[model samples]
Target: MSCCSTSLAAARSFGSVCSPPLTSSLTQMSSMLDTAAEQMMVHKDFQAALDTCDRGLESLANMEQEDSRCGEVKAGFCILGIQALAELNQWHGVLSWVLQQYEHQEKIPAKIMQMCILLYSKVGEPAVMQEAARVWLHCPSNSRVTGFRTVAELYLLHVLVPLGHRDEALELIVGEVGGSAFTEDQRQAALDVVEEKEQQKQEPPLNPSPNSETTAHTSSTQGAVVRKLEAMLRFFYRKLLLTGSGSFSLRKVFTAAVLLYMLFLRLDPAHPSSFMWISKLLQLLKQMWSAMFAPYHQALTHSKGL
Candidate 1:
């Protein structure tokens, strides 16, 4: 028999002893394609690597109705394809491919979606990155991926902010920080972005000459700062109040209170709303302090009574 025939006969024999013929065939095909693509990339044959990735993706499409294991394999193939395109500096091509896949499917795989976001960021396409971030946030499988929340935050700070999407960036950060789905680290990262942006807003223009344009710009910035400060205060207050049962962390409460105090000081003292927020923050801090000492107070009272 010829080499091809002999290899086919051996594959069939192996498949008979394994799980299923189609599953084995697909698995082997994916592995072989991945290896070939990697080798081509190492050799700097980017076009050849891209061609191999295309073949792998075609195979994935043909096996669309497969099991969960197969779905994962397909996602891997998609990632490989994206990487190959990136190696070739075909960023727009990668975006088009991802968008086309999104248009056809109800949901793209989480790993694939991540690759798309990373590609957009790599290509400096902030508008596309923002849209990808929105889709990623809403994806049902997003929670399964590790570090997705951090990735979302980085995208907000690095992409959205530079693109002048300040409102959208703040909205995304506030939503994540306020929601229970985020971890302390993620919440803190979002808060850092808020603080950084607030500082930038507070910086006076180097050119102090009075002009209509500069005055208008300064007013707009001040307004945005006030709104961000209010949003952050609300978030920290909710966090302080929600510390129940095993979730009570005194350190977190203290941190939130300190941040609120700093923000209060940053606000314009003449503004009527600033005074209201300052009073509210002080009351919340007092309540938290009392709550922290309540158990000790009860113990002291009981001992004295005894």
Candidate 2:
């Protein structure tokens, strides 16, 4: 069984059974101290919040011998404490503690990975981010929750980009959510950033002739234009995902997918029927891309004597 499923069963068992004294103490501790930590942190007394977390952990330890639920409570409090420490920018012990706690526990709480991802982000060391990316990539696909995916994306963006690993980053992104999975809007929004970087890298001495600088600048400008269009497309995709109805006709989805395939030829085509939806999506995407690219294209044409 999945660890989440197992943990869910344990939680159910704890809830149904009558609690002994230590169980009662652990429950009380979880309630009282978790709240106090939040309140203290809200008031900007981070140290107090930290102390509350420590106390909460101590209480759970004292109760563990008696309560069947002690292990669960301890895991819960550990996630909360680690998140609090992350907020305080206390990176030194945060990563180790979280990893150790998770490694030993049969299950960490539902949203605990969120805290780990956030803590790693705050630490922002390249080595640490690289490790995080590895964990994110290797974990069972379902191990990724909503927030965890965002963290995973951010980690790759930070670590891979600087290490001259754009191809690796792109491969990871493509494998995780291929073109079909990403809405046209998402692809569009990320386009400029992706294209511009690629363009700058390609700027050449490849043909190191006279006007090499001009050629390089022209390539950079063209890439910037593509990137801008991508950014706008991404904007549209986000809006569609956020606000688009769940009940869109199969026709609409297929049509959109097909249009996406046409627009991004390199992307794998999904259902062939998707081609039918292309006209409508094309109207929207064309306008967005045109607005983004028209000015840049105009300037480029003038510069290149084309």
Candidate 3:
């Protein structure tokens, strides 16, 4: 088949999944979201998937009533949209997009809030989610949701501890949110975890990581290389000095081979300033080549003149 026809066939196949026939069933309600999911997972088209999610949300918003079914569909789009946004590498815009959907931070679904918390935490900006999660946890209506405790745990471990908000963390455990979400034993365990993290923060590391010694090791290694290079150059130069054109041997060729190997292969090994070795070694090799071949070039010129 022609390439254009083949591409049209593939596009039609995608449409079958993305734009399934509209029906009144609950499954049909999420057909658009399924399309977005297919775009993200199957096609790897994150931006198109995000656009599909926006259209699905717009369809949901135009509905007359925000029933439980509408809520579920909306959550599906929002969650898939969040994944799409993250896949697009636009994590910074996630919180604002979510706020635009729900109008208030406290009204965000617990599962969606958990997603936002995990997203920001993964990026090492857990504090970005702190105030939003705090408001959601304090919402009286959200207290009884199935994901409330999970969100609370994420808030404690990902948000609170990472930000060093020990006072607020303690208060959450003893106060309303923690008391409502966690069992007595779970609360105690949470306290121990927080305390352990705090103590670890306060104490100095007993031993540094192996990476901390890299500079010292590389310095010593490079020093040994420089010493070896200098010794090789001196020995070769002296040998060339003692030998005239008649006494010349393949020793110069062998020395040049060794220097080439040193210069070209196994030289850097990921050292940051390895080019310094290359620069110095190249200059040394240039000097050696001149000293080794000076007589040969002179003899060739003299022969040509004769």
Candidate 1 ranges beyond 4 A from true positions: 1-22, 102-106, 144-147, 176-181, 201-306
Best by TM-score: 3
Sort all candidates by TM-score, best to worst. 3, 1, 2
Ten contiguous residues with the weakest lDDT in model 2 = 1-10
lDDT of each: 0.60, 0.54, 0.78
Which regions in candidate 3 have their CA more than 4 angstroms from the true location?
1-29, 208-306
Q: Which stretches of candidate 2 lie over 4 Å from their true place?
A: 1-23, 35-39, 58-76, 86-89, 104-126, 141-148, 162-164, 176-192, 200-306
- Cα lDDT of model 2 overall? 0.54
- Residue 15 of model 2, lDDT score: 34
TM-score of each: 0.52, 0.44, 0.65
Tens digits of per-residue lDDT for model 2, 1-306 = 013223333333433344554445765865755464454445656556567767767666555364446655665556555655655667667656665555632134434544454455445655554664455545565344444455445545556654556766676556654332344565455544566677788888565588878988977874675455455555655554455334256336644754665577442236543343344456666664565467778899999995
- Candidate 1 global lDDT: 0.60
**TM-score between model 1 and native:** 0.52
